[model samples]
Target: MLLPRTFEALPELPKGKQIQVDFGELKVKNSEGKTVKLYVIVFVLSHSRYKYTEWQEHPFTTRDVLRCHENAMEYYGGMTEEYVYDQDKLMTVSENGGDIIFTDEFQAYKQDRGFRVYLCRKADPESKGKVENAVKFVKYNFGKNRVFHNIESWNEQCLAWLKRKGNYQVHNTIKKRPIEVFALEKPHLREVSAPLSFESNLGSSITRIYCN
Candidate 1:
């Protein structure tokens, strides 16, 4: 969402300006032949189309989201000036008339990072399509018809797939591999900082992460 006014403070958003974030899930069979669901957070750098995806066996909670953000930034080697999102309940309490009250924990994290946010309208796809497509890509290209041995194996497979095809293949719109474009965009992104001390209030924890 490269909308006006909100970013007037900066002359213009740099190439490494926004990373679109979205949630998705896939159903697959485990070794026991029982079906299970894996939740995912798909991140796409708007400038490069470079992507990092994290998966969990259970649905994602606020803490998982926060920790994934760290891993995504680390994967990119830095953070962007702003993040683009839809009306995800994980971060926002309400979007009533655009008042935009964020969850207390997310609000604190946003302030501490000193980055900006662009919240897309509910149910709107155009604004954040890159990541939405990424979610689908993960489902069809990687997760569909694939065996889920365990969380660790699924992630390791995804990582190898990302390196082999997901980020390496030339994107239809960009006409260049995401990694190639990301090389140019990376220098302009904000430097990665020490991880924030966000912990889970939820009882569960993620076992493995692909990035950092």
Candidate 2:
């Protein structure tokens, strides 16, 4: 029998060098008091543990992923050099011989944005533990026992909570407020000249429109 090989500990990432992205689903009551499922996209800076989140009423497509990514970068006031992700369908199509094949839309977006993509190996959740913990934190701390009036209201409250609690609170592992660390990391991040464009596919050619 072969023994599993151990890997070295991950090194401390440079500020604004890497960001991890993930998505989670939450079930909550809407304005009509009917239970509905919502999808949340989360992005976490590797060095500072700073995070950003956005909610969608339905499952995300490639376009949605692109839009969320742009929004997250804007929220952080810049972009990172690398982005890590799981084997999510919206971004990844396949893994052929250790090479990841990203979806066309994601590939296009990556080309336009000019950032490296890193996909965690299968069953290796620990590789992206920061964003994974962010998802869990949002579900347990922000979503637990919460009464949401609607998607809009939930998002509004989420932003307020992020400002008051999530970003300001001291992280257990880092022992520092994310917002404070983020302030230091902001200068190292890459600047964006303009907003990203969202493309619509109609028959053959694609039409792109800028979004705020």
Candidate 3:
């Protein structure tokens, strides 16, 4: 018999503001004509559709994932009070009845950051549909849209396009352009502890798998 899904329905935001984060992996070939994998975990603020994406070459543990969020928050200039995610093994320990036991690493990450983590139930992908859609959008639009001379260069180009195309575009969900929403969100964001800069440890967290 199929197992029963137990995750709760996500509650709507009170003031038409929400954000979602999720991880995804894509396969591509490298310059030498070999297969490779790319891991990109992205964050999108719902009302504004302001987006951030990070790419690495390794299976991220919980700590690595949280760092990705921190980078994204730094990019966005503030953290959302809640994040919607799938039931990844890195995040959750167990689900008994309607109760979810978050993994120690994931729980600690949430506590440190101060946000509620909502998990999509097993077999219930729609709970985090925005992120799921964003993942597919990145893969087909960003991943397959063009050929790259190098992965790093491709990623830089991707970030540029993501800001121009993804972040600046008007979202069907909110009917407001991301940049416009971002302007509004900016005033509400918490002050940054430090200026945004590339994190060094992200390089060690991923392995390169290239496809030709």
Candidate 4:
């Protein structure tokens, strides 16, 4: 993939910036009523490359997305200045006149945590390349050939694997590990005591719900 001339140079850490979030998924079996396994959505952070993958038994919804972000922030212990996602209807209720109408719970979560949200422009995948790359990397490495006996145990294993692979792996752009860059960014980032203890309005029990 040829990068635009604008990205020819490496990106610098922006002031008051923490990192970005991306959505990803992995295939899993719905033993309750499955003819076969299906894809389970996962969220990843672009800066630390720290990830929180979960199995969604129901159709992905607004609450599911917020819960995912809440969990991710707790797992990382900080918040990003902005969230970048391709225009998915669940998170984005509507868009008009440069204003994005996000879901009620989503707005509450963002307001409570203090971050901005930006939807990727239509048909412009290049705008969020870093997150796209991270998703692909996660699927290929962690999702491949994985038989999850239990999502809880599997997630623990995944987190361990992510720490080893994401934290330690040398980043191509900066030729440094993600954890290294993240460590440098953390001291400058606004510290949050923890994420709010919000129950899943959708009513599913996420093993690692963000109560941090």
Candidate 5:
């Protein structure tokens, strides 16, 4: 029988040690009064709780995820020693017992960046609570009742919101503003030697995987 899930308080992590990444989706009406879904991805600094988010008109492929990873790193001005992720199909092909088989593209990307990864099952509350909260926060607090103007405008609004509210507000758990905490966390983050670029067939997947 499956045991009941428990949410243990997450301990404070070392500065620049790890970041958690998660993806979610929300629906909004476009300029033409049509409903559309946006794919949202977020990355959070484990120590400071600093956050970076991106929205796309298309579902993310492995290459798209790679590029977004680079973007998130640059947004933070660096990367961390490790990344925590859910068992996303974009990265992981399969898992058995404690072993995980990652997608080919993701395997190479991780090796090229030289960072460690810790993945957990979706039901692992202790592991997913933070990021899952972030996703819900974005969906309800920001995306809810918000009109979809365009990808660029939506992203701009998201960035502004992060600065105005998301990272600036005093966190409920830590009792400190994330931006303030990030001042100390930034120095501990690992530097990115070079930005990653994918092109031609390796670039973003503009069309949905099953899109006509």
Candidate 6:
């Protein structure tokens, strides 16, 4: 026999305290006039609804994941105290009895950067609703009807879109432009004392042992 869990309201998050991350896929035409699937990783500040996105030609490896984190942090000009993620293998290895076993590379990155990691429970997309909507907004707003010559052009366009549309538009829930909200949140963000070197080849393996 099993007991049902009680419902609890989501906690109110402070500025620069939490960020939610998710990945979405988009199909775009290449120079050869064939469609290619591109992975778009999204990071959203939970308190301000500010976001950063990166487009990649392939699914993310551990190295790519770290690089993306660095890029997002750079765009935001700081880091948050906690990162919320789904059960993606790149970040998490398993959920053992309510304890999260994170991937080695990500664990090292978290320890090195000194931020906490929070994983949403299985099948609970609402736990990270901000980033989930960000994924959809990117797919429908920026990605739809867009064509790219190559990955480089796609990335350039993404930054342009972020400037012209994504961050500038008033968010429905927040009722303010992300840029405006981010301005208030910016002062609360943690400054990185030393940045990670993405050039270094961190070992990549889906089978890497999880760390508690």
lDDT to native, each model:
0.82, 0.83, 0.69, 0.62, 0.84, 0.83
TM-score of each: 0.86, 0.89, 0.77, 0.76, 0.89, 0.88
- Model 3, which residues run further than 4 Å from truth? 1-17, 148-151, 190-212
Residues 1-212, candidate 6: write the lDDT tens digits: 89533222366589989999889998977667889899989998998888899988888887888888888888899999999888889888988998888888788888888898888865786688788888888888998878767788888888898889899999887789989989999999999654566565544422222335
Q: Name the best candidate (by lDDT).
A: 5
1-212 per-residue lDDT for model 2 (tens digits)? 99543321367699989998989999977657778888999898988888888987889988888888888888999999999998888888888998888888788888878999888864787678888888888877998778777778888888888899988899887889999999999999999757765655553222444556
Candidate 4 lowest-lDDT run of ten: 4-13
Clash-forming residue pairs, model 4: none
TM-score of candidate 1 against the unseen true structure: 0.86
| CA shift of 95, model 3, Å | 1.8
For each of the candidates, give the backbone clash count.
0, 0, 16, 0, 0, 0
Candidate 1, residue 154: how far the Cα is off, in Å: 1.0
Model 1 misplacement above 4 A:
1-14, 200-212
lDDT per residue for candidate 3 within 1-212, as digits (tens), equals 99533322445353235578788888877776666788888887765667888777777777667667667776787877678887778788888998988877567656655677777764676676667677777877888735445667867887897878877777766777878878877666654343222234554332222335
Ordered list by TM-score, greatest first: 5, 2, 6, 1, 3, 4
lDDT of 2: 0.83
- For candidate 6, which ten residues in a row score worst on lDDT? 202-211
Q: What is the lDDT of residue 10 in candidate 2?
A: 62
Better of 1 and 6 by TM-score: 6
The sequence of per-residue lDDT tens digits that candidate 4 reaches over residues 43-75 is 544554444565544567766666666677666
Measured on C-alpha atoms, candidate 4 has an lDDT of 0.62
